[model samples]
Target: MSSSMASSLPPLPRRVGWVGTGVMGLSMATHLLSAGHSLTVFNRTASKAAPLLDKGAKLADSPRAVAEQSEVVFVIVGYPSDVRRVALDPDHGVLPGLRPGSILVDMSTSDPSLAEEIAIAAASVSCQAVDAPVSGGDRGAREGKLSIFAGGDRSTVELLSPLFEKLGVLNYMGGPGSGQRAKLGNQIAIASTMVGLVEGMVFAHRSGLDVTRWIKAIASGAAGSKSLELYGERILRRDMAAGFFVHHFVKDLGICLRECQAMGLALPGLALAQQLYLSLIAHGEGNLGTQALILAIERLNNTRLGDGGESSG
Candidate 1:
C-alpha cells in the first residue's frame, strides 16, 4: 500500500469490531476508527481500551458483544491461548456471536495449527476466517505501515483488501494457517539477526570503538538489515521500551522451534536465540522490548552496552 491516509479508504465495511486492545491492537484499531468505519472494541482489561473509547469507538462488554455488532471483526491479542479465548471460547468468544457470512481476522503472531483450528471452527458456523499475522512491530502499527501476511480463501482476502491496505501492504500466502507459517519464518530470520547484531555490538564495545558510530558506519553496507537499522540505535541508547516485547518474540520463536521439530529440522541459531531470550525472561525482563536481548549478552560477557555500568534489573 502507498502512503495514502487511512481516513481516505473507500468502500468501508458496514461495521468493524476489534478485540484485543494491547500495544499493537490499539494502533491498528485506531486506523479503522479514523477511517470513519463504525467500530466497536473490546479488551480483557477495560482500562487498556480506554484510548480507543476516547477516539469515539464504542465499548463492547465482551468479544461476543463485539462480534454480534460488527460485520467484520479483527483480533490481535497476545498469544495463541489468548486468541483462542477471545475467538473460540464456546460461551463468550467471538465465534458464538459472529453471523454466518461475517469475517474474522486474526492478526496475532500465533501457532499455525491454532489458525487452522479457528478456520475450521469458523467454517462450522459458516463464518469466514483469516490468519493474517503482521510484522514491522509497534512502529509499523502506529504508523499504519505494517506488513500483513494473510492466509485464507482468495475471495475473502480480496474482499478485505481495501481495509487491509489501510493498515499496510497485504500478501496472500495460501490456505488457512499459511500466514502463521510465513510469520514463523520471519521470526527465525529475526532471531538469528538479533544474535548477530548483539554479538557484533559487544565486539565493537570490547574493542573500544564507539558503538553508535560503528552502527552508522556499517548500517548502509552489506552488514545492514531491517533489524539493525530499526533497533540498533535504540539498543545504543539503551531504550528497552517494547516496540515488540521480548516475551512475545520469545513466544514466536518457541512456535518456530516447535514447527522446526515437527518438520524434522534443526536450526541451531534459532534455538540459541530462544535460549537467550528465555534468560531475559528469567531475569524478569520479559516485559521489556526485544532490543533488551542485548542485556542477556551483556550478562554473558560481564560487560555493558557503552558506559560499562552494571546491567539493571
Candidate 2:
C-alpha cells in the first residue's frame, strides 16, 4: 500500500525475558517495560543490567532463570557462538526451562542455521521459537522505532505481533530461517551502500569541493539514506564512535560473504567492502563505528577529512 497508509507500530510482550543487555537490547526491553509488560532481564555482566532492575524490571540470575520466569525470551547478543551459549547451554539452558506455550525470539544477527536449530530445540520443549532480528540501530530501539523482521509459524507470528509492535515496526516475512535471510539481504545491501558512501566521501575530499555542500546537496536528493544523512559527516570526517561498531559490521559482512560464496554468486563490491573493512581492522579501527570505513577509503585516496571529522554520538 501507500507509505502513509502503512501502519508504524511496535508490539509489546505480555511478560518478557530480555537477554543480552547490549546497546540495542536495553532500549528495546525498556520499551516493553514502559508499555506496562512485566519484564525480567539477564545480562552476563550484572553491572550493565542493574539500571533496568532499578527501573522496576525484575532481575534474573541467568538466561535460564529469566526464561523460566517469563513467557517470552528475547535475545540480542553479539555472535552466533554467544547465541548458542546463552540460549542452549546444557546445564542451565533456556530450552530446558522455557514453559510450554512460551516463545523464544532470537534477535541476534546469527547464522540462519542456528535459528533453525533453536527452533527445533524449542519445539522439543513444546515451546515456540522464531528469529526476529532488528534494524534501525540503538537510537531507534530507544525511541521504539525499530523495524523487526520475523520468521516462524503463522500462528506464532500472529501471537508475537503485539510484542513486535511495542518494540518496532513489524514485518512477518516468512517461515523458519526467513528472518535471517532478510537480515542477510539487508547486510548485503548495507555493505554495498556503505562502500559507495565511503567512495563518495573520498572523492569529494580529493576533489577539494566543499564536501559539506557536495554531500548535502546530493543527500537532499535521491541518493540519501538514514546511514548517509545521519552518519555521512561522521564518516566523512573519520570521527568514529561506538554506535554501530566496525567490528560488528565486519562480522555481519563476513556472514554475507559466506552466504554469497555458498550461493556461488560473485559479489565483487561486497568483497571489496569486506577488504576495506578488514583494512580498517588491521589498522586498529575495529572499535570505531562501521562508518569508519571512510577513513580507510580516505587513506587509499591519499587524502584527509575535509574538516577532520566532527563527531556525534
Candidate 3:
C-alpha cells in the first residue's frame, strides 16, 4: 500500500489480548498497545512480558484470563503442541474462557490440521478462529510490516483487517487451515532461497572476491530475494544474531516437509535445506539466526565468509 493509504488506517479493536511475547510477538503486541488498544498480555516467562507491561499493557495471569478479558485474543506461541495447550486445553485454555463472538487469531507457524481443530473448537463456543501465520521476522515485526497469511471466514478476516493492517500486509488464503499451508509454502521458498544465498556467498569467499560487493552486484537481478537483501550484509559481517532463530526455521521446515510427505509430494530442494539446517542444529548453533546458515556452508566447504578477525558465524 501507498504511504498515504497506510497513514489513514482505521483504529484497531480496543479490547485486545496478546499471548506469547517472545521476539516477534513482543513487537506485534506493542503495535496494538501503541495504537491505543486496551491491551492485556500473557507470556510463560514473566520477564519476557516485562517490556509490554512497561508500555502500559495490562498483564494477564493465563491464556483463559487473556481470552476472558478481551474481544480479540492473538496468540503467537512456539510449536503446534504449545498452540494446543494455549488455545485448546480444556481447563485453562483460551477457548474454554472465550466469550461468544470473540475472535481467536493465532499467528504461530503451526500445523495446518491443528488450525482446523482450533477453528472447530472455537465454533463450538460461538467464537471465531483464524490461522494467521506471519513472515518478515523480527525487523518486520518491530517495524509493523509483517506479511500475514490468514485463513478463516471471510467476514471474520475482514473484521480484523484494521488490526492486521497495523501489523503488515494481510492476505486471506482460504478456510480453516489454509493460513498454515500458506506459511508452509512460505517456509519452503525461504529454505530454498537461504541455501542459494549461502552457497553463492560461499563461492564468493572461495574465489577471494569481496563478499559484500558480490551480494550488491546481483541483489537486484533475478538472483535477488528478501532473504538475500535482509541477510547479505549480516553474512559479510559474520553477525549471526537471531533476527529469526535457526531452530524456529528448522521447526517451520520440518512442518513443511511433513505436510509435503503427507500429500505424496517430494521437494528435493526443501529437503536438502532441511538437512543443512538440521546439521546446524546438530552443531549446537540452533539458537543463532537463520542467517547463520552461512556458518554451516562455511564448515562444509572449509571456507569462511567474513574477515579473519573475531569469528562469530
Candidate 4:
C-alpha cells in the first residue's frame, strides 16, 4: 500500500457489510474480517457464506438486513440484473436499508449506465455510492492485490481509502460511472488479448514446438502480458478450474460490445472474442475457466494442446 492511498478518516474495525460470497467475494470479505472489522455478510446461497460465518462474520437474511447493520456496504454479485436486484430492489435491496450518509460500494463488473443509476438512487436517499469494479481475478482477490477502479464522489472515495487499501491499489477514475467505463475498457483489452493468447498457444502446439518452453521463452519478451503470465501454466496443465468463469467473461464482453456500439464504434476483435466465448457457453463449458478458450481454438484446428489429438469439443 502506498502512503498516499491511506485514509485518515474512517477508523479501524468499522462496521462493514459484504454482499456476495462467491469465489472472489469470499476472499475479499475475508480480508476485511481478518483486518478486524465488524463484518456482516449476505449471499443468496447461505451455504456458500459458511466460511465467513465460521470465521466470526455475521450472516444477514437479505441485502437490506446487511445494510442496516453496516456503516459501509460492498456488493459484488454476478450480472447487472443481480446488481439491480440487490442494490435497488425496493423490497429487499441495500439502498432501502442504508442509513443517511452511509456508503454503498458496488465492485461488480456491470453496465456503466447502471452505475450512474445506482449513484443517483443512493443520492436520493442521502447516501453515497461508488462504482469500484476490480481486476486480477481470483488469485488477485485471494492475495488482496486487485486493481480497484473507483468512480463517484472523490471525497467519499477518499474516506473509504482505509478499506480500499486492504483490498488492493485504488485508481480513482472519475465521477459516477467512470469506474465501470474503465472496467469495460479493461474487458475490451482483455478479450482481444485472450484471443491472441490462445491462438498463439494453439499455433505453437501445432508446430511441434514445446509449448510450455515457448511460453517461458517468450513470456519475458514483448509478447508478455498479465493474461499470459496468469493462464499460461494453467493452460499447459489442462486445468480448466474457474479462476474467472467463462460465463462471467462472456457477460463482460457483451457489455463491452454494447458500450462500443452505443459509442458508434466498430470493434471486430472484441466481437470475435465474444463469439468464441459464446461458443464455450453453447458447448456447456460456460462454467469453466476463461483459459478454456484454448479448447475452442483447438477445435477449430483439429488439435489439442498437449496430445496433438483431435479436440473432444
Among all windows of ten consecutive residues in candidate 2, which has the lowest summed lDDT? 1-10
lDDT of 3 at 138: 91
Over all chains combined, what TM-score does candidate 3 have?
A: 0.94
Q: If both were scored by lDDT, which would come out higher, candidate 3 or candidate 4? A: 4
Q: 28-114 in candidate 3: lDDT tens per residue?
A: 999999988999989999899998899999998899999999888999998888999999988889999887778899999999999
Error of 3 at 236 (Å): 1.1
Evaluate all candidate structures by whole-model CA lDDT and list the values in order. 0.88, 0.80, 0.88, 0.90
Q: What is the lDDT of residue 41 in candidate 1?
A: 93
Q: Please give the distance, in angstroms, between residue 123's alpha carbon in candidate 2 and its true position after superposition.
A: 0.7
Model 1 misplaced stretches (Cα beyond 4 Å) = 1-11, 307-313
Write out the backbone clash pairs for model 3: none
Please give, for residues 144-197, the per-residue lDDT of candidate 1 as tens digits.
999999998777887789889889999999999999999999899999999999
How much RMSD separates candidate 2 from the native structure?
5.6
Q: Candidate 4: which stretches are off by over 4 Å?
A: 1-13, 307-313
lDDT value for model 3:
0.88
List TM-score per model, in order. 0.94, 0.91, 0.94, 0.94
RMSD of each: 4.9, 5.6, 5.0, 3.8
- For model 2, residues 20-134, the per-residue Cα lDDT tens digits are 8888888888888887888899888988887788889988888899998888889999988888998899877677768776788899887888888888888777777889998
